[model samples]
Target: MAMPFFNNMLALLGAIGFWPSVVYFPVEMTIARLNIKKRSLKWLGLESLNFICFLLTLASASAAVRQITQALGQYKPFMYKA
Candidate 1:
């Protein structure tokens, strides 16, 4: 159970933490402190970057889910194959 859930848990952690800490907060803070205009090129770029990061996160989570599902059928507890 725990073994199968490891990847899912990792995906959840990254989705929850990576965006806010790595992209969202820093980008928003930079915009706010610099007074970037709403529709300006720089603002658009930053927002786009944020969106890209979000997509990456989504893709990773989906991949993890896919991997777990595929492995689940063959999963055997404490049965090591050399």
Candidate 2:
């Protein structure tokens, strides 16, 4: 029933939550670091933007994980009316 939907939702959430950290942040940070080493003025702005993006990604990941955990905790096999 809803279990399949929840499972799919969890997978999607995990992908969205982890992809930034795994892919985007590292690449951006590396570029920023290279710019810094080269003494490029754009490095400052790039680093700042990277920081902001990191924070946003972190928040999203945290919320997604929290939601997944809450859903898992509240899951029930069956419900019966009293």
Top lDDT hit: 1
Off by over 4 Å in 2: 2-40, 78-82
lDDT of each: 0.82, 0.65
Estimate, for each residue in 42-64, the C-alpha lDDT of model 2 and write its tens digit: 76666666666667767776766
Scored against the true structure, residue 59 in model 1 reaches a CA lDDT of 80
- Please tell me which predicted candidate would have the highest TM-score against the true structure: 1
Residue pairs that clash (backbone atoms under 3 angstroms), model 2: none
Task: Please give the RMSD of candidate 1 to the true structure.
Answer: 2.5
Q: How close is candidate 2 to the true structure, as a TM-score?
A: 0.54
Assess the local accuracy of residue 21 in candidate 2 as a C-alpha lDDT between 0 and 100.
Answer: 67
Model 1 over residues 1-82: C-alpha lDDT tens digits?
4585676667767776777799888999999999999999999999999899988878877777777687777888888777
